[model samples]
Target: MSDRRILPSQLERMVYETIRDEIVSGALRPGEQLVEGRLAAELGVSKTPVREALIRLQRDGLVEIAPYRGARVIVPVDDDIAEITELRVCLETFIARDIAARRPTDVLEALETSIAGSCKALADRAEEQFVDRLSDFSDILAEACGNKRMKKILGDLRSVLHFIGNSSRRIQGRAARSIAQHEAILEAIKAGDPDAAAEATAVHIRSIAEDCRKAQVPNGDGRLPGPAANAPRAKARTRARANR
Candidate 1:
């Protein structure tokens, strides 16, 4: 752990982003322990900021801290993902429809570039690059809609979804399919077919959500039995608690 002086705000942001990225990348899987002492040492910051940032993340739906137990990475279940996908379908479909009707040339071009980058990253098996490019595609669609409320909502939702397990692992030939979907959406927008574009966007998000759900454990139920020697200890508190 490197020790360096940092402002209060910077420390908090740094802690938040570090933990968030770890969760998003699945480096910290669901239900994994987040020991304050360990994290503070790793980040070279006092536990105060780390604790505060964790509380903020809990509010943001990224972590769950139970009483007497430490924070644990959250994994959305099938139901949770379905609801999220439905919300995304509604929001993004509307954006696609609007973009199609308005035909923003620059936005379309930006989306094309993102799709190309995403395809290349997928081919190279670069997970970070693929995620970044996919994000850019979403950003372009939201910006094209010209709705501040929609943009903020989508951005926040994207953050939450980032923590979900990646489905890219199962999609053996997903890059080509993803590119085709994007091309279809873009073509519809270019042709000024709002209805088709909206439908296409809805289908795309649904497919991604389904893939993510498949990667998760059955129904997202993630409980493990305690060690044989600790069976008695488990009877008292089956669930973990927040740390002091």
Candidate 2:
């Protein structure tokens, strides 16, 4: 990639995309500070565009801007994550049902392709890409549902969840299990079984939610506990809702 400083408009676009991608991909982990000067230098751009980009990212709930701390990635609280996952389960299950009812062969093929990629990502132990690829798969499903309102809602929900932190690495075999679920959904869709697809998708999301519940808690803790460990999660959720 070119390290050259871009023009004003290009710089703005690049800065936004770069920071957003880093945040979503988990390249910049949640709670990691975003040093404007360093980022500008790294991207070979001036701090002006970098600052603007940070503001934009803040609005997108991808970064938190504090008086002394500047900008940092947002991490979602247990409740917020749980809520988002619940919303996703509802929306995605509906999508699977609608798509299966319609029997869209092309969309099913696309989802299968995404599932294949997700399986490979899991096999390679690439958590970041795995989550992102899975998100793409989800987008396809939502789009295939043929409901604009649902798509918009799911898109906004995804933006909030992405900022919270990539949760794909929560369990060892979670990714593969997700892929299997996708396959099951695809099969249901192929069979023109809307009810079965919806059931499978809901089960898949619930399984992930269970895994996240485990991952978010420490070894011994069953539920989210302690103000100390929970502080970051609370802050992230507040920032996310505020930004939205």
Candidate 3:
């Protein structure tokens, strides 16, 4: 047997994980500028790996790069939340129904484990771990629904969720409330009630959206637009117009 050594190939991946963790943990604030040279210096590496890692983050939708202004952590706006919520409600409600009807044993066990992990994280006040496990509930259902496309789409959506989850957790009682909602979805799944599970998932998603919107605060460079500012523009359909 030969001993394995850390290769140059692994540096990029290592750098990527470190930066991604900082981003997701809110150690690196949203919309914070990512300077490659500084990151390389902090990680004790050259700029090459740092640059590569940032490109990966950009692909994950966690970072945004400009032509000359450099890269910054994504600060999701209200529109982003609304769009994500709508998509998740549509996709996950379907997943909840499908997975509930099928009731795959392995998937059920995974859901149970996720719930337990989240519960422990909540008691310990481990916000990062709590969010990871809580997010897993939707992810597990997405995977078990037998739709690869949906799974990948939801996976990509997890990037913006880290910021939202961190914000939502700071709101009083939200952590416990989220756990209860997850339990509701899981209980409905266990009882083999597709409609109940689906409805539960829809309710869970909508409530989270509402909470995230409330939790956002003003930042240094900008503010996440409030619901009033981000309201979806709807075409007027007045009765007077109908008379035409």
lDDT of each: 0.71, 0.70, 0.76
The ten-residue window of minimal lDDT in model 2 covers 223-232
**What clash count goes with each model?**
7, 0, 0
Candidate number that wins on TM-score, 1 or 3: 1
Candidate 3 local lDDT, 37-151, one digit each (tens): 9877667778898899899999887899999999998876789778878888898899999988988899999999999999998788675577779878877887787888888
Q: What TM-score quantifies how close candidate 1 is to the native fold?
A: 0.82
- Give one digit per residue, the lDDT tens place, for model 1 in 1-244: 8866556887677677777666665556656788888777666667898899789889878789999988987766778788888888889899998999888779878988998898898788676787678668777888777889998898877667655424333444444666777888888988999999998888777777766665554333554211111122222112111111
Put down candidate 2 lDDT per residue, 8-107, tens digits, no spaces: 7765776677767666655566667899998876666678888998998888777889998799876656676678778887888888888888887789
For candidate 3, list the clashing residue pairs, or say none.
Answer: none
Error of 2 at 66 (Å): 2.2
TM-score of each: 0.82, 0.75, 0.80
Error of 3 at 147 (Å): 1.8
Task: Please give the lDDT score at residue 240 for candidate 1.
Answer: 15
lDDT value, candidate 2, whole model: 0.70
Model 1 weakest 10-residue run by lDDT: 235-244
Best model per lDDT: 3
lDDT of 2 at 230: 17
Stretches of candidate 1 above 4 Å error?
1-5, 165-176, 218-244
